[model samples]
Target: MTTISTVDATKFKHVSYLWDDAKAAALAGDEVALFIYRSNMLGADLRLTNYGGGNTSVKLKDVDPLTGQETDIMWIKGSGGDIGTLKKSGCAALYVDRLRSLENVYRGIEFEDEMVALFNHCIFDLDSKAPSIDTPLHGFLPFAHIDHLHPDAAIAIAAAKDGQKITEELFNGEIGWVGWQRPGFDLGLQLRACLEEAAAKGIKLRGIMLGSHGLFTWGDTAYESYINTLEVIEKCAEYLESNYGKSRPVFGGAKIDSLPEADRKLQAAKVAPILRGFCSSERQMIGHFTDDVRVLEFINSNDLEKLAPLGTSCPDHFLRTKISPLVLELAPSEDLSDVAGIKAKLTPAFEAYRAMYTEYYNTCKHDNSPAMRDPNPVVILYPGVGMFTFAKDKTTARLASEYYINAVNVMKGAEAVSEYTSLPRQEAFDIEYWLLEEAKLQRMPKPKALSGRVALVTGSAGGIGKAIAKKFAEEGACVIINDINEERLDGAKAEFVQIFGKDAVASTLLNVTDAASTEQALDNACLAFGGVDIVINNAGISISKSIADHSLEEWDRLYDILVKGQFIVSKAGIEVMRKQGFGGDIVNIVSKNAVVAGPNNPGYGSAKAAQAHLTRLMAAELGADKIRVNTVNPDAVISDSNIWAGGWAEGRAKAYGITVAELPAYYAKRTLLNEIILPVDIANACFAFVGGLLGKSTGNALNVDGGVAMGFYR
Candidate 1:
C-alpha cells in the first residue's frame, strides 16, 4: 500500500471550486441536472482524498406549507461514499435540527457514545447504505453543500508538532483549526458551536481544520464551496510541502511469526460478528487473513504504545471494535497450538490496559450518570503477530482494520522522515476538550472590497470567462457582464440581474476584438453606471494549429481577439479611469505559453506571448496614469475549453499515449513544486494584483504557473 507522505510535493497542485447560490438554485430547480451535478461533485470530492477519509453533504431543507415547520434537512454523503465517485444512493438524509440537538446534550455524555447515537438518528433518503462517520458533521452545518478532505499536504502540516500554532500563523483569518477529534457527534458539536461563535463575532471563516482529521469548507453553491476548500487546502498544502512537509527518518522492524491457515480461518470467523455489529447491521461477511510472516513479527514489537495509541490513527474508531487485538507473536511457522503460549506472555499486558481504562473512566465521573462502555483497550499490537480488529459487523471490522492498518503504515512511513509528533499531549488534550475554540468558528464572510463596486467582465458567457464574471457578481459587484454571442450574453445577463438585482447588473453583446465597438460599449457602460474600476480582459480564444501548417491569417485572427481586443477594451476603459482618477485595475488572462512555447498551437501561443509582453508595456506606461496592468499566467487549466475532459493534465496524458493515472505525477515531476496550475489559481492571482498588494509590481511577470517557467526581469 502507498503511504501518504508528510511532505508529498506532488499533492499541492489541484484547484478547488465552490457552488454559489445561483449554481445551487440551478441545480435544485433542475432535477436531472441536480442529480448529475451532485453526483459528479461527490465523486470528485471523494477521489480528492483517501478512502473513508473525507466528508460531503448537501442542504435539503425547505419551509413547510400551512402549519409552518421549518424542517431543515441535509442530504449528506454516507460515511463510506467517496465524494469523488458517489451515487445518489450514497447520500443520507438527516433532520438538521435533530443533528444539531446532539451538541446541547454532549456535555453530559461521553463524546463517542453521543456521536454514535446521533449517527443512528440519520434516515437514509434512498435505500442507501449506512451514513458516513462524518454524517453528524454534515448535519451540523447550515451550508447547502459541504465537503471535507484529508489532502496529503494539509495533513502533513496539521499532523506535525505545534500544528495548531503553525496553522494559525499561516492561514490566519482565512482558515480555522479544530485540533483533532474522533469523527462524529462530538466533532459536529464542536464545529456547530464554532460556526455560531464566528457568526456572532463576525469572524469570516473560510475553512476549518479538524487537526488530525482533515479540512472542511462549504458554499451556497457546490462549485464555490468545493473550490474554496480546494484553494485553501491547496495553499496550505503547497506551502507546507515546500518548506516543512519533507522530514524523512530511518527506522527498522523486527521479525515475528505467521498464523497457521486453520487459526487464521478460525480468527476470521471469530471477528466476523464484531465487524458486522459495528457496521450498522450490514451483513457484509467477506474477511481477509493476516497470516503474513511480516505482519506477525511487527505485531510482536515490544514498544507498541511508543509506536502509537490504541493502534489507530485517530480516536472514535471503536465503531469497528471494542479494541484492536494483537496476534500471538511466535516463530515463523507457528500453529494454532502456540496461541496458549502467546496469550500467557501477553495476559499481564491486557490486565494492565483494563486497569488503566478503569482509572481514566473514574477520573471523569460526575453526578450525571454516564453510559457504560467496554473497558478493554480497543486495539493492541504484538510485534510479530497480525493485528486483529473486533467488531459485530464485517464492514465495521474491515473499516476499522483498514484505518488502523493504514495509520500504522503511514506512521511507519512518516517515521522514515521524522518521527510523527502530533500537537503536544497537553495541547491535544486541550483541543480535545476545547469548547471555547469550538464556539469560535464562523462561516467565511463575503469580500469587503467587492461589496459596492460596479464592474464589467468581457467574455462573461462561458468557461473561465463566465466564472470570473459570476464571481464578481457574487461578491456584490454591479457587474456589466458582456459576451460576443448575443444568446449567451442575454442568458448570462438575465442570470446576473436575477441574482444581484436588475438595477445592480447589466449586460451587452459586443465583439471585444472590434476597437470601435468596444469603445462604444465602454461609453455605454459609463453611461449606465458611473465608471468601471476593474477591467478583466478574459475575452479570447485558442485554436490548435502547427506552425508548419499555420498561416498569417490564423495568427492575426487569434491576436485580433486575444491581444488587440485587450488593448482596445483596456485603452477605452483607461480614459474613463483617468477621468475618474480612481486608479483602475486591468487583468490580462495570459497563459504559460506566453513564456514557454506551446509547440502545436503557434497562432494562439504567439498571440498570448505578445499579450504577455504588452502587459508589461502597459504597466510601464499606465503606472503614471494610475492603472494597474497585470497578467495571469494560467497553466493547464482543466476545463471544457481545453482538450482535457477531466483536467489538462489528464487530457495531455491521453494525447501522449499514457494513462490518465500517470499524468498528475508526471506533470508534477516536471515542475519544481510539482503543482498543477488551474484557472481559479489565476483568478486568485488576479484578486491579489487587483487588490494592490503588488504596489510597484507593475511591469513584472508574477510566476503563477506552478514555477513551470520563470521569466527574467526586463
Candidate 2:
C-alpha cells in the first residue's frame, strides 16, 4: 500500500483565489457570477478536472415561505452546465431540507426520470435550473460549500485494484472512505453514514474518497473547498510519483516500432480522408488524431486485445467514448499513403467493427429494443499509425479524443500502482443505455445542411464566385476559395473571416487555364480539409467577337478560360474524390447563351456551348463512380460583378441600346418572372445542385434565366 509521509504544500497551484477578484465579483452585484468565476479557475486545469466532470455548490440564506424564517438553500453546478464556461444562470438552486427528505425514497430508485421528477418538485426557487444528478450527496452533507471532481491524479488511485488501500495510505488517515457503489440514493446514504460515524469518533473530516469513483471536499467558503481539492489531489500525485510512476511500460502486449514522427503524421494524413469517407451514414464523419506518448505506447503494444476489454476508467466516459475503442490491424503490404492499400484494409476493418458493435448492442439491449443507431466507431486504433477518433462534428470528435488521452494516462497510473481496473462491462452498459443519456442524444441539435462536408469554389474572390463560396461556408461546409486575382483573393479571405470565421475558409491562387496550376490548387483544397467532396467549376472569362472578325488567338484564349478551365479543375478534383470512394458533385456554371444564339458573341457562346456538352459527357462516364456532373445556365446577373464592372456590362448595355444603369431593368423585364438576377440568385441555383436537392437529376442543364421560353426543355 502507498502512504503519504509528509505534507509538502508547495507542489500545488496556490492562486485560485485573489481578494481583488472576489471583491470585484461581489461589487458587480451577482453572487452566482462569483461561483462561475471560481468554477472556471478550478476547471482551467485538465489535471484537476474536465468539463461536465465536476460539481461545485454554495449555501446561502433564504426565506422559507411556509415557516417565514430564514433558512439555508443550496446553489450547485447544474446538470447541463460546463464548469469551464459556467454562467450565472447555469447554477441550480434547491432547498436543503427538501432535497435531503427525498434520500430515503431515492435509495431504491435507480431510474433518472423518477429522481428528476422529485428534483423538479424540490427546486428551491422553482425557476432556477435543474439540480445535478449528484444533488443528494451534496445536499445531505451539512457543509457550507462543497466541490466534487474526478481529477486524473486522484482517480488514478481510486481506480487501482487495491485502490481503497492505496487511498488510505495517500490520505495519511485524514480522509474518510466510502466503499464501491453506483452513485444515486444508496451512495448518498452511505456517505452521510460515514460522516456520522466519523463525528461520533470526534474526528472532523475535510475530505472523503469514494472507491473506484472520485473525491469530495467541503468547507466554509468556495476558496477553502477549492484549495482542499487541489491539496488532496497533489498528495495522491506525489504518492504515485514516489511509488512506480517512473518509466512505466505501456501499449498492452504487442511490440511494434512506431514510425518516424514525420512518417507518422504523413500516414495519418493519407488515411484521415479515407476514414472520413468510410462512414456509411447520412451524418458525415469528422476525425481527430492523438499522438501522446502514453497513447502511442498503448496502441503500439502487442497486448492491445488484453487491455481493450477492460472498459473505460470511468462510466462518465461512456457518454462520449462508448465502452472500448475498435482496434485496426495493419498488414505488411498496406502502407498508409497507398490509397488502394489503405482502403482495402479499412473497408473490411470498418465492416468488422460495425459487426462487433452490433453484436454488443443486441446482446445488451434485449428488453429496451430501442432503435439502433448506425454502428460507427467512435475511437479507432492502428498500432503503428496512431489513434483516430470519429464523430458527427468537430467538437464531439475533439471531446472523444481528449477523453481517451486522459483515459490512457489514468489507466497507466493505475497499472503502476497495481492492476489497472475499470467498472464491470454491465455497469458501463447501464450508463450507455440510461434513458437520461439517451434523451440527451435525442436533444442534440440537428446537423447543419453541409455538416461534415467540404466544398471547393474557384473564382471566389468576388461576385458570383464569392457568393457561392460564402453560401457553402454558411451551410457548415469547409470552403477552399480560389481565384486568379491575388489582391482580390486576399480581400475575399478577410471578408470571409468576418462571415465564416478563419477555420472554415482556406484561400489559394488558382490559374484555371493551366493544368498544373489547377491540379496544385485542387490538391491544396484536399490538404486544407481532408478531401474535397464538392467542386464548383465557376471560373471563366468572356471575349466578344463575330465568327468572321474573331482572330484565332482570341478564340483560343476564350476557350482556354471558359471550356478548358472547367475541364482541368474538374479532372484534378475527381481524382481525389474517386480515391476517397465517396460520391461528389461538379457544378459547371455554363451560360444561357450556350443554348441561345446571339450576334457579335460567336466566341463566347461557342465556348459556353462546348462546356455544356462537356458536362453531359463527364456525367455519363463518371456516374458509375458515383460522381454527379451538372450545369446551371444563368442568363444575366445585373449586380456588381467582374464581367460587368466596366468592359462586358458596358458593351452589352450598348448592344441593347440602353444605358448601363438601365440594363438591369431591361434584362429583368425580358424574363418571364420579370425578376432581377442578382449574384445570390445564381448562387442559390448552384447551391441547389451542391446541396443534393437535385439528388436524382444530374447530367442535365437547369436554365436560370427566370423562365426563358426558348431555353425550356421541349
Candidate 3:
C-alpha cells in the first residue's frame, strides 16, 4: 500500500493549504461534491495551478438509470471549465467499464486522436458536459481519486535539464518519471505502464512527474488525495528554495533599471494606444497594462533576450500567451516622453514579429491544421516599462499577462538550479493548432456588438448619462463613468461593478467645465482601458428664465456647463482617439429646446443651440479621421433626471402655470404621440447613433421626444 503522509503547515512557504475539516465533513458521502470542493481548494492558489489549466477526477459506484444496477462511473472536469469556478454541471460523467474497454480496439500512437470520439459513447449521464481530452488519462488510472496539477514549483523541476535524476532524489524513488508527449491516449498508456513497472520492482509509488509537464498524485480517498498533492508540491518547493538560495545573481543579474512609478505610468499611457492599434489590425482588441514587480524584474534581466525566444514550457501558458512574446528594443534610459520617436521604432518591431509568426505557421502547419490566426503577438514586453497584453476583451487580456507571469516564475526557478528547457517548436505548434482545440474555439458564443470598445460618459452617476453607460456595458463595452457628485458617483460605480464586474467599469470625479479636469478625466479613461472609443457629452445644467429676469451670472453658468463643457471634453477625447488611429463616436446630449423657440427658456435654449452646432462642425472637420459627431435631442425626461431634481421641475411648472405634480401629464399632452419620455428613451437614441447601426451616417440629429413637431430639424 502507498503511504499518504500529512504535510506540516510550517513546511509550506510557496503555496497555501486551505482545506477545512468541517467543510469537508459537511460534504461527505457525495463523491462529486467532494471532488468539486477539493478542486476549488487547489485552484484557489496561483502557485498551485492557473485558470483552466489542470484536471481532477473521482470514481464512484452509482445505480445505472437504464440498467437498474450499480455500476462504476468516473466524473472529471469538462473541457474549457476553470477548476476555480467548477460547479456540479461542469463535471462530465462517463461509464468507467466502457471507457476502459477502448484499449482492446486501440490502434498505435498515430491513431490516438481517434480515441477522443470513442469517449462520447461511454457517457453515463446524457446531460453531462463534453469530456476533456485528458479523460482517458483519469479513466485508466488505478487510484480512486487523482489530481493532475501544473504548479510552478513542480514545472520548474519538470522543465530543468536534469529533471528526471532530480525527481528520483527528491522523492526517494517513491515517484516515477515519464518523458515528454502531448496529452492523449498514448500519454495515459505511458502513465499506466510506469505505475506497473514500479509495482514490478516491489515499489509502492505515491505519484509520478512528467518531463516538461507537471505532477500527478493520487490516493484512496478524497481527503487523502488532496493531502498527498499538497505534500508532493511542498517538497518540490522546499527543494527548489534551498537550491535557489545558494545561486545568487539570478537570471544573470538585472541589466536595466525600472522607471519610477509615476513615470512608468506616463510611458505606459503613451505606448499602449500605439500597441493597441497595431494589434487590432485584424480585429478590434481590448488591452491590459501592468507594471508588476515580477514582470519588471524579468524585463530588466540580461537573460530576457535568450529565454523569451524559447517560449513557455507548459501547454496552458503558451495557449493563452501565444508561443512567444514580442520584446520591444528600447534602452531603459531612453527618453520615453517622445511619443513620435517611440512609434517610429515600434513600427519595424511589430512588422518583424508578424513576419516571424507567419513563418512559424507555414513551417509547422499540417494539411488539416486550422488556418493561421491573428499574427500579432498576444504579449509584449518593454525593457523599462512593464507588460502589455491584448485580447478580444479585458478579462482575457489580463489573464494572458498573468499566465506569462507564471511562466516567468517557472523560468526563474529552473535557471537557478539547471538550464531551463521549453517545448520544441514542432510540439508547441502541434498543440496550439490541434483539431480538438479548433473545435473548442468554434463552440464559443458570438461576441456582443460593442465587445472590445471603451466608452466615457460624463455625468454618468444618474439620469440619462447613467442609463447610457449601463446600456454600453450590457452590449459588452467597458465603461468609464464620471460625475462631479462624489456620493452619486460612488453609488453608481458600485452598482455597475456589481452587474458588469470591476474590469468593465471605472469611475472618476469630473468637472467638465474645467479644462484641466476634463483632460485628466480622458487620461483616466485611457489608463483604465487602453484608450477611449466612445465619448458621450451628457453633463449639463438648466435655468428656465426669460431674458429680462435672467441675470448675467445665470447665463454664464448655463453656458459654462452645457456649451463650453461639451467643447472641452470633445477636444480632449479627439486627441486620444487620433492617437489610437481608429475612428470614434461623439454623441452630444442636446435638448429639443435648442431647435424650439420657447418662453421662459432663453439661457438654456441658447446654450443648447451652441452645443448642437458644435456637433455638426466637429463632424465635418473630423470626417477624414472617421470620428462621427451626432446629437441626441431629448425632451421632458423627468424621471431620475438630475436637471429636473435641481429646481428645474418647479421652474418649468411655473412657466406653464401648473402644479409640479401635473408636469408629467402636461408634458405628455404637449407631444403629438401623447407619450411620457423617460431616461431610457434618451439612452436608446444614444445607442442608435454609436452602436454601429449608423456607422455610415454622421452629422445627424436624432429626436426621442414623442414627436415634438416644433422641434423638428428644418
Q: What is the C-alpha lDDT of each candidate?
A: 0.57, 0.75, 0.89
Each candidate structure's TM-score, on Cα atoms with residue i matched to residue i, is 0.40, 0.85, 0.97
lDDT of 2 by residue, 475-527 (tens): 87888897898998999899998887766778889999998888667655644
What does candidate 3's lDDT look like per residue over 1-714, in tens digits?
A: 332244456666778878787898899898889899989998898888998888999999999999899999999999888888888799899999999999998997889889989989999988888899889888888898999999999999999998998899989999899988899988988999999999999998899998888889998888888888988998888888887637666777899899898878777776677788888889888888889998998889999999999899988898899989999887655675565677788889889999999999999999999999999999999888899899999989989988999899889889988889999999999989988889889988999889999999999999999999999999999999999989989999999999999989989989999999887787677666788899999999888877899999999999999999999999988887877788899999998998998889999999999999999999999999899999999999999888886678888899999999999999999999999999988888888888888998889999989989999998
Best by TM-score: 3
Assess candidate 1 and give its TM-score to the true structure: 0.40
Q: What's the lDDT of the predicted structure labeled candidate 2?
A: 0.75
Better of 1 and 3 by lDDT: 3
lDDT of 1 by residue, 1-714 (tens): 111122243443643333344666766664324533644554454224555556666775555453467676677666545655666666666667666666666664354543554555645344645666677777776777777776555554556555667677778755677867656566776887777777787887777777765678877765556556666767764564354324422224343334565654444333322321222122112222343443443454443445555333333222333333443333433342343344455556556655664554465444542433455443434333355443322234345555555454334433433345443343333333334222222222533556435466788766666677666666555567788788988887787767766655667777988887786676556434435678888887666556776678867878898888988888877765654444667888887778675446677778889998888889888988677888887766554333243243443464455787776566556677778766566666766676546756676556665667443333
Total clashing pairs in model 3: 0
